[model samples]
Structures are given as C-alpha cells and as structure tokens.
Target: MIDTRRLRTLRAVADHRTVTAAAAALHLTPSAVSQQLVALEHEVGHRLLERDGRGVRLTAVGRILLGHTNEVLAQLERAGADIAAYTAGTAGEVKVASFATAIGLVVAPAMDTLRDKEPGIQVRVLDAEGDQSLTMVLDGAVDVAVAVEYRGAPGEDDLRLFRIPLYSEPFDIVLPRDHPLAAVPDHDGEAAPAPERDAEMPPTPEHDARTAPVDTSPASTHDPRALPVDTPPTPERDTRTLPVDTPPTPERDTRTLPVDTPPTSERGTRTLSVADLSGEIWIGPYPGNPCHDVIALACEHAGFTPEFAHSSDDFSAVVALAAAGAGVAMVPRLALRGTDLSGVVIRPVPGPKRRVFAAVRRGAERHPLLIPLLHALQDAATALRQAPSM
Candidate 1:
C-alpha cells in the first residue's frame, strides 16, 4: 500500500527539488529525508529519485508518481478546506428531518435565517413524522431530527441528541360564527347563556298592599281611636269604561320558544361516552410520522380510530385539510399561526407531547462549527418559546 506519509514526503521533495530543501520544509534533517525516500522507493519497488551530482532529479517513473502525488495533494487540500468551512459554520450541508407541522413552524423559519446568514451552508429538509424522524436521526440518515412526544407517551430520555423545546399552545374549540354556541353571550371572555334561551329577566315583585283612594290629610292630626269607623262599599265599573277591584292578569309572550339545551342533556341515567366519530374521517401524515402517531393515539384513547382520509408530505396540505373540514389533525401550533383556516379548530390531545432534538454523528461533536450551530438552535428555541404567536 502507498503510505500517505511517504507520499507527502515524496511530493514535498518533488516540489522543492532537493532533499535538503524538503527536509527544511518538513522540519526534518537531510539524513532523515533521504532515509524516508529510500524506504518509500523500497515500498514501491521503484527508484523515485536519481542523483544528479550532489542534488537529485525525478526518474521517469518518479515523474509519473509525482503527477499522481500532485493530484492527491490537491484533493487533500480541497478536503481540508471543506472541513474548515464546516468548522466555521460557513459552508457544508446538513440533512434534517421533521414533520410537516414543524417544517412550517420551526424548521422553515430557522432555515430562512440560516440561508440569509450563511449562503454557503445548505440545509435539506425531509418531511418525516415523529417516529420516522427519530429513526432516521438514530440511523445516521439525518443530521438533525424533530419528533413529538405526547404529554405522557413513552419517549427517548437520554441520547447523544440535543433536546430543545420549540413551542407550546393551548387547545381551543373552534366553531363557526353562525354556530349556536357562537351566538351565546360571552361574559368576560367566558361563555354565558345559550343563544337559543330566552333573555334573562330579573324578578320584579308586585306591590302586595294598596290603600283605597283617600283625601290628603296629615296623619298626625288624627288619633287612631277617634277616626271614623264606617267604611263605604267598593266601587265597580265596566271593563272598558269603568274600574273594578279585581287584580290585573300578567301578559304572556305568545312566541314559541326552542328548548334551551339538547335532549341528550336532559336524559337520565346515561353515561357520557366518547363521541361516535366512525362516520367522521381523520386526515394526517403517515404512520411513522410523529404528528400522525400523536393524533392516532389521542383518537384511540378517545375511543375512536382515525381514518387517514388524505396523506401528504406537505404540512401545509395537512392543515388545509383540517381547515377545509376534511378532517381533524394534530399539528404544531407554530405552523397554524396566521393561517386562515375557515372552520378548522385546534384542540389538545389528552396525551403526551412530542419532543424535538438536535443530533450529530457521535465523533462529529469535535468539529468547530458544531458548537455554534448547537448554540444557534438553543437560542432559537428560547426565542420560539417566548414569542407570543409561536
């Protein structure tokens, strides 16, 4: 085998054209350079240099070897530059895998910044779900991967990957503006009364006692025991043109009213079961996808199996489906922000949360640029968490 050390020495000597000069360049004694050259010639079974007086010149075979040596040296220099560029975080490529939700939310935005900041750096994003992303990262198919863990689902704890929190959003029930619940009065941002119910009327008590028509007189002027005792008979009048002593009847509204609550609410001895959504189709990514697993398990725990009505690698497409009423989908909150989803609603699955991490090849940690990239990701994660809309 041709030794790299010997090749380097030979190439150096060829460039400088003298063993003494090559020794000086390599920080070796002249005797040491001569000895290495002899060993190299023995290994190759060919004389690489011929003595020309006190100096040396390349033999015909040595000339050919020198040409090849120059090519090899050039290749090594290029390789070194590539490594240096990668170390400086100014060049090279990174393969990243994540789900559609995160691709739109975290990865895409971060990539935008990276592109603007480092033109030479290339990032390739793959649309992979949670479990798939993890598998890819672990298997060395991807440099970095983002996966989700539900609020309580089992997941990786300790690994070579650098874990970071991207974002967290509260789940909310989505309803159309014309929904009955939409019309319900809101008191301090909270649901008040059902829209179909009659407007509330505070009770107004009637005057319980009334005194007969009497002349105005000072009550203090007359003593109780001395007042006239005889009382006249009650006056009566026609219903239209006269007054009567009878009490007036209260007026009743004649408009028919709808039931305030659903009949299911009024039923007795019934248990509230998970909604029967067998007829409702579910839409999400594939099985190995993190978001897919989250949605599937959430639905399963909720007593229903989700039907994947549409499968797409594009996360935007998944969200569009949910917004279009095609189906419900579990997605990262960041991706859904500022998106105009007409009827889509976001709800939290009563399950575990997906955790995302930064990963690299085991020995690649020593690379200089890795640390900066790691810090950038950490800072980005913090910024994401603090951002209002993320």
Candidate 2:
C-alpha cells in the first residue's frame, strides 16, 4: 500500500512546481521533501521526478500516480468528515482560512455567537485569499475556507468540493472627502446637508438616472453624458408620523438597496463617471490578490487601465491611503464596515461584485461543528444585509 503522507508530498510538489516552494508550504525541510519523494518512488516501483535545469518535472508515470492521489486524498477527507460527524463530541478545533475583511464581517461574529452557544467548538482562523484558502481546504490544512468568487475559482459542479454561498456584495468607489467628485456642486466648499434624524430621504431623479444600466463590456467607455449633474430635490417624509410608541412601518425597517449604497444626495449633487478618474492614481491590492483582478477587470470594462501607484492586500490600508489623499480606491462594501471614514466618502459604482461563500471538502458539510458554524455565519450575514449604510 502507498503512504498517504508521501502521496501528499508528491501532490504538493505537483501543485507548486518546485521542491523548495512545496517544502515551504508543507513546513518541511527541503531535504525532508526530497527524502519523501525518493521513498515514494521506491514504494511505487517507478521513477517520478526528472531534474530539468534547476527545477524538477514529473514523468508520465508520476502524472498517472498524481491523478489517483487526488482521488485517494478526497476519499480520505470524506471518510474523516463522516467519522467526525458520528463522533460523540464537538470539542475539537475547526481550522478556517479567509480573506482579511471576512474575519470581521462573518467569521468574528460567528465566533462570538459560538463562544456562548457552543464553547466546545473552537475555530482557528488564518488570513488567506480565495484561491489560496481553497487550496488549503483541498490539502487538508484547513477544514473550511470563506472565499470570494473570482476568476479561475472552481465551478459549482466541482465534485471535489462543497460550497455554501453567504452573500454577494458590490464594490464602492472610495475617495478622499475633499475630492472634486465628492463635493456638491452648488454647495461650493461647504459640507453636504445631513439627512434628518427621523426622515428617509427619497431617491432623486438624478439618482434614478445614475442607477440605469450602462454598458459594462471591456470595449465600452462610460459616457459622461449619462451621469446626472442636477436633480430636483424631493421632500423628506417623516418616518415617525405615527404615535410616539407605535411600531415603525415595514418600509422603515426594510432596505431598498444594499446596506452600503450611498444615501440619496440633494439637488446639484454630482455623479461621477469612470472617465473622470482617468488621470488620478489608484490604490488597490497587489497583483496576486483576487481584488486586484476584480479592480483590473472593472477598469478594463471602463475603457481605461488604472495606474496603481499604491498596493496593499489589506482593505483598511487601501482605504487609509485614499483617505490620506494618496489615491482613489475600489473596495468591497464589507471591507469598509466599522472602518474610519473621517477623510473619505464612499460612493456606489456600477462595476464588478464579489460573491462570498463558505467552502469545505465534499461530504464535510454535515460535520457537527460545521452545522452550528454555518448557522452563526448565516445569522451574521442576514444582520449585515439589513444594516444601514455607514
């Protein structure tokens, strides 16, 4: 029988394409990784690796073994999950990997809820992006991964994984409060008027016009004429028209737009088009990050390529850079929640959206701890969906 650990080492080398890289990911010494590969070749009775220049390439026999290794590993995962489900207690740790913002938006809140409700189940979280986290889950390094949909992610029908969708959040344009596009035209340098304490401001005609569908194809440029510069002000209706102790109307409690959608602006409020930002420097994620791809694709759709002058994987840092007047940024709504917005104004933009999901190896969905964790995440997502815009 082949050793699973040696098979794992072989798979890691295949994924990373280099012994040194696979060694780093597996937390094994380069010599140890090499030893494992050698031992596995002897067990299999076939040569697996061939040195090409400084790197190694898998032989035809090695590729065949890798295919079986993937199936065997997936089967082992399912077996483990089944065993865990049937076990008496939920006292073990469930390792999780996720992007930075999701730690606050979903995982943290779920952990808080679980603290009192299921103290026996401890959750371990590691900061990782969508693709990396998924890879970790597949490799058994993590039990679950909270990830966002991005290019090259596995499809829904992928038999090797199970996915639970949490939410879909739109990207928002984050700019310095003092930026030319953020100011109300007629108000000059004065701050925009604040909404009344107990009133909901109705959407203006200009807002309606701005929300109209636009061509988002890669070859299209946002038409400047499509943006609304002036709109007639609508009267603010009092939300507290009922008796002091009366229950609020459903309209007052329901959200008509996303929780992070910008509030309706009054007359003379200027809507910005992507073309207007063509010359400004951008702050975004580094090249390997999923958000970086999303931003790049959105820019391509807008008929311009952004000059990314500052890059950070941390959304807070991106926002901070924009707030400091370093450059503008495009960020997911959840990333901005509870962040310091003192020098920034976040506005809605018609662009790409990210769909967040919780992923596990196939057949691990019913693990005892995972069920409660999923409930906690769902509760948090529902609350966040109903929350008012910041």
- The per-prediction tally of clashing pairs is 14, 0
Candidate 1 wrong stretches, greater than 4 Å: 1-91, 108-127, 130-132, 150-279, 307-329, 345-352
Quote the lDDT for 184 in model 1.
37
**lDDT winner:** 2
Cα TM-score per model: 0.44, 0.73
Off by over 4 Å in 2: 42-47, 50-54, 57-61, 129-132, 157-160, 183-275, 388-390
Highest-scoring model, TM-score:
2
Instruction: Summarize candidate 1's per-residue lDDT along 167-256 as a digit string, tens digits.
Output: 333212222333333333333444332211111111113210000011122332212111111132223321111111222221111011
